[model samples]
Target: MCNGLLNPAQYREPQALADEHALIFARTWNFVGLLFEQEAGQHRGVKLGATSLIIQCDKQGRPRAFLNVCSHRHAQLCEQGVHRGPIRCPYHSWTYDREGIPAGIPQPQAFPEVIADKSAHRLKEFACETVGQFIFVRLSTDGPSLRDYLGPEYDFLLHASAGMNGLIDEFRQDVHANWKAVIENSLEGYHVPAVHNQTFMKVEGMERGHQAPVDTVQHPLHSSIDHPAAADWLVTFERKIAPKIGSWAWRFPHYTHHLIFPNLTVTSFLGYSFHIQRFEPSAVGITTVHSRTVSVGFTGQSPVGAKMVEQIYAESKSFTERVFAEDAAICRAVQQGLECAERPAVIGNGIEDRVLHFQRAYQRCMNPTSPPPPT
Candidate 1:
């Protein structure tokens, strides 16, 4: 059995939050948005920790990321949400090209120094990459590539992204809790009986004493849980309709939930649909959960098959929202308790092994030189 590696104070301390923003979030690849959904010449603003960023598609339809602030007077270039047209500064009408270079200056004669070296005044650019439809951004220039950072999850995400046709639903909620608290809650299923008793615990195969067997896979950067589908109706329906919709990827029906290191999770049932969620740290005690559900379809899916997929998506979306609400409420309570807590949390050896795996990874990043915790 392993104990929690993070100190209770780390959840509520301002300085600890700052250290995390710099050491963990900044140095890691953060999930931003879906590349396939963005229109050509569309740009949207996103926040990673305290850093503001703008993700846009260039003329060539390539995804690019840059600091949201204008190079001229430090004004924000675009507001949150998608915008069409050029990346123009609202303050002074300064505009930037796809490569972050200042292409148009209102008065070239006003500042000869800037005109002489336009490259020096370009918007600060960050690293951006995509695997299939998923897009990721990194603030630090020096680090592993997105593939290297994702480790074993890279190939899985690639296949998942390719199968996803489009987004079915999306929402964002600001929770009054530390970001770590929110993520930790998601890494284990021990709370299902209590926190999700009315929702998840009531699922066909998820009843208190009759739950299906679950297998946990742990890696240096990620962890996942796989279990056979317990819902008889869903499993039977999928098996019958899968051939018409697309080639079945797996021999048997199962549910998978994956945690991608720092603060992202991907969940699916039999690869038919994926629920992607990212826990973004907004402040010391505020975290925003950005969630979206995407449907998977094949090239020659029949009309009947498409309608069946839609029905499945509709039910999944409702179930997902209920479970998320339950999780958010419990996470808030956990954060409130941590405000006065002085001891480390206990880690169980069963379902919560993933939680321990995550905490150990966090400790490794936050204290690179420290000796590894005992197994």
Candidate 2:
């Protein structure tokens, strides 16, 4: 009769899921949208996995993030339109100031002072910090500052920003695969040679040449980040990936930051920058990815550099599309196999460690009060 059975122990403990998220998302900094694009008083909305938030700058131009809903009506304050005026919920017309205070309310006579508790009713806030063009937000009222949360990864972002005054171009790719699968692929570089073999994989593993990072989570099959040679086919390809570019990416819990969260990935070649977010759910493994891209040099750049950069970006986009198509095919197959119990259990190798780390983060955040997952 179509049992609709789910093996929770093997996947997660439902009760502990929220608590686990509190542990992970509460304390860890979440990457929000870029800070530079929005003008002073400008507001933007972002959805991270399941949580949706609206970000706005204070009078000082500093950025802040809060749950977009109004306290009284439980209606979204930030409408679909990005407005510069005070945030107002269309449902009841309740309004909040940029600092997230209850600035105004329609038909106020109905409520007494004790019920308003303006401070408590204001839009719920989370701690946030800005660096360069990026913004980082933490869910809990208490946690380490965004700077400390980044650890050594901060250096990687700084290095990527050295040359470009800011981002020049941006792009996002949508894939029909699980968010976990998409993130794990980003963390490991094992597929570069086999999957991206045509245009990019052809490059030599040298700075002067072309080679993507190798997947390091696993041993035996693991390889070091490609160090390329000049005048080689790889160098030519690297020019396409990004010439005069310093690259760095990190995989954190829930979402991974390229360079740094909020920075909007800036690949030096042609100044191509891409900022992305992915949402997932247990009921369905499919993930929805949203991306924003923009041209960095608001002032513009040299013709020679621009031409070569555009060429590289075009080729890179082609290669990225093909590789992701391959990943989607494989992940869909994996999901189908699991749903059907095609194989009772699957063993993981070193490369699979990234997935293992993801699961652990999920478990730690989920806090499944239930039994352990299937072996």
Candidate 3:
């Protein structure tokens, strides 16, 4: 935490903020990382709170994760430090085999061959699952499947999650605010008209609300966004998406797959998204948020279709850039205000309740994992 550790009471329990995060987000599937248009053996690096993780293919070509630590002296086995390979530990010539196992100990007879048990020495693996084009890891291997966690929102993101081309167009921004602030900003469309003045004017957020379908779903994992009129419109416009996707779902706790319980919040209208912010709280008062743009159904379908999709995504990105700047400005100012407050409390409205919901949910985990979130 920026100052001392965060006040335990302020959150639900006494553990430090870092510990709580590992429990709620890290151990769970909290958007640990993503698998872009990467090949089976290609490697990519991602961070969870403060830890670095590598996602890559093993010699068997299976996806695996390791602490990125070298076996000999525990030096990081990576360069800057993630890339696909025949990875060679730079510390010593100690080479680890695929699957993160220490393949060989330099001198054969000096060390007992049994001392370097390939199975036991292998890189510690967290259970990994690929959902659509995204990748998720749970520190614990035995839990719900990713879909089981997604619950109801799965109906909406199925197709676009892969896009026709299976790629994600990304935009990253650093905001001087708490990670929670950015997540709260995205939960509801409450700020669309005012917070996004130019964006709203440029795009149409005329209808602002979460879909009723989300409330009714008991459990939905990967879903297709299905709106009758929107579906019809997509077909009507051959110049646009080959298929129409309409909903958002979630995998809970860590990652919201942009559908039901998505790790982040997203709004999609005419393939123009409001924002799906990914926040990294470097310190209590500092956070980095990435506003990633996803190219979906339309982009990969046809040349004309891809152009139209790109045009929409580009326009959406512009609006997001403008409005989010305002959000950053407000958050910066709020941090300064909190510095002086004694016991500050926030007022809540119908839409503002979303933030309260997240905070309450986070608090529940501090002492005992409270009840699972309502279906």
Candidate 4:
């Protein structure tokens, strides 16, 4: 068993939250959206802590990220959703190019200083990169590249991304809990029997008695669990239907859940479908959970197979949403308890080992000088 490194007060303290925003979120590669989702000349706004960014696809069909604020009047260029046309400021007719340089000025002659030195007036650009279909941005100008930051998980994400065709469902909800509490809840399966009894626990062949042993993989910055499919009705159904539907050639036959540091989770069942979730800290006690589900396409061009895949995707989305709602309720209760509790929580060695792994990573990031917690 591993003892928790983070104290209960850290979950609800204002200073601790601020420190996390600076030392953790700002320095890390934050997931923005999928590159395939953005069309050419389209831009979408996203937030990393207090920093707002615009992840846009250029005319050349390349992904770029820039500060959402315009150079002329510092007004927001785009709203939260997808927008087409140019990245023009609403306050003035100032337009920015793909490089975030001011390309069009309504009254250029009025400001000769900007005309002389346009580089000084350009919108602040940040580091952005893509791994397969995913797009990530870093607020700080300097840090490890996204690939290096992801370490061994880089190959896993690349393979998973290649299998995904497009998103089928997306939603965001505000959980009344600290971000750590929300993430910790997801890192462990200890609560599944209680919180997800009706949804996840009830999945065919996933019952407490019938489930296969989970294989855990731990990295310096990330962790994952792979639950091999049991030899039951569901596994048999997947084996028969997968090849018929022309699923990805490189797909897994098990359920795998991955946690990429600070607050991102990528989970898949049989590698044909994926659920990408991010727990973004909105405030000291509020977390915004952004979730989207994507599925592999039918390449065999069978109408019957396509129909089957659609039905499966629909059922998967419904089940995922139900489990998310249940987890949110439990996370809220955990946060409430943390606010009044005085002792540190203990972690188990079995199913909850990943939770302990996450806590250790959090501590290492927030306090680099601290020694590792004893196992």
Candidate 5:
């Protein structure tokens, strides 16, 4: 094994970053946002590596995605998400419906040739699909279906996200780091003691608390980690809300972490909450990370008067925000260290198996000769 590490040059080179965009981001199912983020008749602009897309729900509430560039002048239709109606080009009022078919033109008489073949000039569309409450887009037309690409781990993620609805919150910030640094930080729990010692360790009582060792399951496209809560937390929860908690803890058994190939990292926390973190690489050493959360309840609406459930949900959000902040800091620090030639090449121990797994999957995508890892 090469320790599943990329050299410092690989991390800093512009061409390598471009290759990553072409090989990985262009070809995979990238988590965009929760379905609730965009409303019917409204469009949201999202970027996947180098591709820009517009995700909108039609008047009939059907989801659609199109290249954000206008077909006529090639100007971006919208810089940011807008609420109201059909997408209209600011330059000439050229309008398109949710299906990306040209709907209107400022003056049909002025451009007979353009009007004669509107279909030929329709906005390009991308493949869009939803898993649970999350929306994902594939920049390329060809690839395995999102479900097949996700493989068996898709079901586990679906079950863990059952009843999840509208996004509760999302945190976005550009980090001065390579995307791999952010991905590596998320894939391994080994940094919890050092990077998150005061936050997660103190909160979970894992600093000195006796807890079952975390267990992990690996797949070609994904890997998951299941961590049991601290013994004291479980005992107290059982005493207070055993019936409400029911078989959830037993069935779920862990605060699971899944690093979905390409860009999404999802975590199921406390059996009632899940977070999807997307790492979007903007340049060789720049990444934009978005951390989003959703509530697990019927119809994306929180139940009324469920104080304990509310408490746990609120606490989970607070905990994730804190942990994410810690992770972002360390990822940036690692990015800085990676620029030094004297810095040691990366290596993953058993506890960082998911990190290795991610690197393997990434290599398979970026290298023509690298075999796809076992699914």
Candidate 6:
């Protein structure tokens, strides 16, 4: 960002990363995993910042998230996905129902007081919410509602990801760079022409492609890129599926990229296809990236139409992974460059304003004393 780059210590210092994990991510609604990816009656593990959690659908099929630790001995429960059954703690076999209620104990008579007070012994739950099948959890006790946090941009993101099919293709990479660098790389198109010269440049062309003029707008809790061709490539794809699944018209110059503060990137691929990416930091200069392409409102098509859509989805997924590989390598290099005792701040061209906005948001979160961006 041109305003002020984060100090090298911010990326290299363990203490700084810890503060960010707590202040920036844990306090906000952090996107975990897609709700649709999990089975109706099962438990799946997910991590947000430093907290490991278990997400499950109740008997009535409502989604819930709780700390993975068991109440008995605080042993991690359900390390992986498990089918319909009580969540039994491996340490003491204390069982929990779908609602995370303590259902059974080996010697119920011995601990009558503990058994009577079910609420205290139930799974430790975090504030959980969902937006268009994507699940988010906040470890902090209080904060703005997810809807309030997203502002009007919530509708914009919902439109982009509303009916995404089960995750079809996913590409995860352990990026050896600070999570912020990964996010900065995702926000700006300035590096596309140069960094993605071969992969993305081949399709969109040098001018009208990824390097094309980007009109960026910043909101209170999020920012977006207004790109004309965001939906152009999907015009044909949408038309083909329109007959089977009625017309789904999206506003022109559709959203090319949308960044929800801390860590969530929702980008439009074609008509109703969206790519969701999250940059999660595990430690200083270490991040785990989760990228997935899901089809929105795609279902009940003829065999031929389905096959064609699958082909397009696979091809596009491959292209995206290749582009991401390029970006990840560049981010690592940028991280390595930050090792200098004092480095020149990165100067973003006007086109990279989104990066500056993101940094501003990051600063606001890390240091609550700073003024927040104008809504």
CA RMSD per model (angstroms): 2.3, 7.5, 6.7, 1.8, 3.3, 3.2
Please tell me which predicted candidate would have the highest lDDT against the true structure. Answer: 4
Q: Model 2, stretches more than 4 Å misplaced?
A: 1-20, 79-84, 108-120, 161-176, 192-284, 292-301, 317-322, 341-353, 356-375
lDDT leaderboard ranking: 4, 1, 6, 5, 3, 2
Candidate 6 lDDT over residue span 1-375, tens digit each = 344546777878889888987798788988877877867756787778888888888877778889899888788887644445567788889988888988988988988888889877888888988777777888899998888888866687666555666666786678989898888888887787889988876764123544355655547458887665545455654576545544333434444778888898888743457788988887788888888887765555667766666776787788888898899899889888876547536756777778777777787888798676443
lDDT of 5 at 348: 54
On residues 47-135, what C-alpha lDDT tens digit does candidate 3 reach at each position?
65666666776665456666666656777666422466555677766766556666656676765753746666666667777666555
TM-score of each: 0.92, 0.68, 0.72, 0.95, 0.89, 0.88
Per-residue CA lDDT of model 4 for 134-227, tens digit only, reads 8888888999999999988889889888767789899999999999999889888788888887898878655565565574556767998877
For lDDT, candidate 3 versus 6, the one ahead is 6
For model 1, what is the alpha-carbon lDDT of residue 366?
A: 92
User: Best to worst by TM-score, what's the order?
Assistant: 4, 1, 5, 6, 3, 2
Q: Quote the RMSD, in angstroms, for model 4.
A: 1.8
Query: Clashes in each model (backbone N, CA, C under 3 Å)?
Result: 0, 30, 33, 0, 0, 0
Point out the higher-scoring one by TM-score: 4 or 6.
4
Q: 4 or 5, which is superior by lDDT?
A: 4
Candidate 2 lDDT over 41-65, as tens digits, reads 6678765434678889887788988
lDDT by residue (1-375, candidate 5, tens digit) is 234456677777899898888888899888887776677777888888888888888667767788989888788888744547888888888999877889899868987877898788778988888776667888888988979988876776667656666566777878788998888788776788898887777765343436545645456657777676667777776666655534332145457777788888887756566787888888889888877886665322223336666776778778877887788788788887888755436565666777777777777788857666453
- lDDT over C-alpha atoms for residue 35 of model 2: 62
Cα lDDT for residue 141, candidate 4 = 90
lDDT of model 2, residue 25? 45
Candidate 1 TM-score over all chains jointly: 0.92
Which regions in candidate 4 have their CA more than 4 angstroms from the true location? 215-217
Candidate 1 wrongly placed segments (more than 4 Å): 204-217, 231-235, 238-240, 243-252, 299-302
Q: Model 5 misses residue 246 by how many Å?
A: 8.7
